[model samples]
Target: MTARYDEIGVGYALGRRTDPRWLEPVVSALGAAASVLDVGSGTGSYEPPARDVVAVEPSAEMIRQRSPEAAPVVRAVAEALPFASGTFDAALAVLTVHHWPDWRAGLTELRRVASRQVVLAYDTALHNDFWFVREYVPEVAALEDSRPSAPEIADFLGASSVRPLPVPWDFTDGVFPAYWRRPEAYLDPAVRRSCSALAQTAPEAVSRGIDRLRADLESGRWQREHAELLELPEWDAGFRLIVA
Candidate 1:
């Protein structure tokens, strides 16, 4: 996974900027935690500004893009954190567990280093149904389904709560599912490159899907089909916040 990020993380910060609204649930879950360990923290985008945060990321390419003023970062993988037991009040893993080669081991390390764990995991049963994946890029769903599900992750963490994190229509994170309401965002090559699912997918598959999507958009077919979505302020893109 580190190698994968090193290859794809070029210009990652360009498309993957922090959306302040996305941090609300994460901070709320952190309660009174003074220190946070952000595992797989790419460019420190989601690390809460108020917390004493330390980031751990394995990819040097991604690390190179981090702001100089961002939280201090350690070069390490989630499976083997360098921190001692109970080093942090809470550990945060946002949309990154599926990238782990041994997610269980990584999550266990989170448990060892922090009293509480907050993970933003997706529920594929709901996520795979999103029109972009269900229609254009079924490969993304196929790839993601092989990873741990929300229930499985919550069970592993003994999560106290699992709540859906809906994607606002104007979401700025540029994650794979963040463009549910804005279909044309998928047409942008930078946007595609930013999302790991799209970046990892076969180019031919993605090209074909994008071509079809472009045609549909140009023909106004997509607008007609998903007209109902335009009225929604937010939609559940199957993002789940697990607090333990």
Candidate 2:
């Protein structure tokens, strides 16, 4: 199935750019690899400067947005990679596995192609932790909770070892949990458009949620309860890098 990346994922590169704080750990998990495979490398967000990276993504729009400096972009799905067996020293699938039709098959493909390591970065659950999910949009949280779990993914990989890395970032990337601390940003249409949940949900539901959020912000109801979050520099919203 073709994802509407062109329509919804258009401003993603500009708004959802990689957080530098997360890069060092993600790249380090790849080990001392010379050649790397960046699976679902949308807009080349986290492609490291050191390695000889090769990117693979299914979305044509996402592939088209790849930087000139990034590795050559290939239009391919994770369930079935186009490269030869053991083609890469390490592989990275960052925040993209949930979109795959067959996550198990995709993990198998990642294992089959990589000689050294396979790093998977994604959030475990968005519903339980953040106030946005617990308060304004529980439906979106329900949608996200259906995604595969970290343990399930690790089992599929037959990982000899699994390490959990923390998710720490400063600014919101227009993604769901990105604005947990900055509730005011969610009121912006541009910010709301960047969220897949808001984009995929029924227009009426999204509009209702937006309207409620707007009312809460205007009445200072959001601040009255979650005013403490403003003091924090970053939050650990159940995001992790699963290194195998």
Top candidate by TM-score: 1
On residues 1-244, what C-alpha lDDT tens digit does candidate 2 reach at each position?
4856767887777677777777777787788888999988888877877799999888877877777878898888999899899999898887788777888788888888997656554555743456876676667766677778766777766666665544443553445677777777777877777777677667777777778888998999988888777777776666667767
Least accurate stretch of 10 residues (summed lDDT) in model 1?
A: 1-10
N/CA/C clash count, model 1: 0
Residue-wise C-alpha lDDT for candidate 1, range 120-231, written one tens digit per residue = 9998778779898888988887888888888899999999999888899998889888888899999999999999988998999999999999999999999999999999
Q: What's the count of clashing pairs in each model shown?
A: 0, 0
lDDT of 2 at 205: 73
Task: Name the runs in model 2 displaced over 4 angstroms.
Answer: 126-128, 160-169
- Every candidate's lDDT: 0.91, 0.75
